[model samples]
Target: MTVDHTAPGDLAPHPVDLRAGELAALLARAHNIPADVHRLPSGEPVVSVYYGLVVRIDDTCRFWWVVPASVGRRRPLWTSATVPAVAASRIAGHYRELRARPPGHLIRGGYLTADVLMEHHTASAPI
Candidate 1:
């Protein structure tokens, strides 16, 4: 999916207070992964800890990391050889906490909308 790029100040209807790099660092430090933080062409920070994984933390501080659903289904959810176990567990806990609340709890500044989650779910479902 293409990321909508507009001036950070003009993009979101509301102020985006979170820094992607900060969130990524927090997650990485919490999980103990060595975070390789880089800025996208649009200046958004993209953190890569493992070879095949990339996490994009939007302006709102919500995170999205790409991983194979089959790998996701395995034990100690979110574990990857590329990510430290502590980091994986932290990420898993983040999702667990988010899942406990209504979807609205995670929504902020129009980033990571429910539609995105739905689309990811639909796309990842078995054929």
Candidate 2:
């Protein structure tokens, strides 16, 4: 599906449709944020050492991703996206590529919404 290009400032989030196996594999190879560096708890730069993220994939090929609002918190805020299978596969593929890259490359400074996944959905995203 094509991504909506409206500005992100007023955008709302729904559920993130993800490929389960793809998401799991991505987390397996992802790195945690360093404690020394201060950063936002949500949106881009989410991976942390304390607790991992949650993901779900459906037969329709839609997927959802959820992460705790705070470190080690049980409650989570989730976001869904409208991404086609090819795009989803590409996202998974990027993680796979990163698995071979250094830790610094895994740090993602991006955002996601219901209709739009990220800048990469339409163009290239710095990995």
Candidate 3:
């Protein structure tokens, strides 16, 4: 089976698909964003992390937050050809928000919606 790497908004296949080791190295430096590189059934490497952040490198080496379909249909978060560090920082913040959310807020089973991932958490929100 051919695994399509075209994310929601892309018109064609991405030219630069980071190898597993390269993806792992980027995540390894992100101390707070617990992540691991895993292969798709088609053998494509994807970086999986908490809060349903399954990242893919594409569109000339940019980072994208690929959302799981079980949760929602929001567009993936694309970093637009920026450095990995910027993507890492955004991912770290995204993780923090998801971690801070109150139980049953936007999580279902073991998955979460991209909408909740982008929402701002308030100080008064119950954890």
TM-score of each: 0.39, 0.27, 0.52
Q: State each model's CA lDDT, in order.
A: 0.45, 0.35, 0.53
lDDT score at residue 18, model 3, on the 0-100 scale: 49
Which lDDT tens digits does candidate 3 get at residues 22-107?
Answer: 55565567554557766455444456666566565543565666333323545333333257766676666666656666547546
How much does candidate 1 score in TM-score? 0.39
| RMSD (CA, Å), each prediction | 14.7, 15.9, 12.2
What is candidate 1's local distance difference test score? 0.45
Query: Which candidate would rank higher by TM-score, 1 or 2?
Result: 1
Name the weakest run of 10 consecutive residues (lDDT summed) in model 1.
74-83
Per-candidate clashes, comma-separated: 2, 11, 0
Stretches > 4 Å off in candidate 2: 1-18, 29-52, 71-75, 82-127
Q: Output the better candidate (1/2) by lDDT.
A: 1
On lDDT, the leading prediction is 3
Candidate 3 TM-score to native: 0.52
Ranking by TM-score: 3, 1, 2
Evaluated against the true structure, the overall lDDT of model 2 is: 0.35
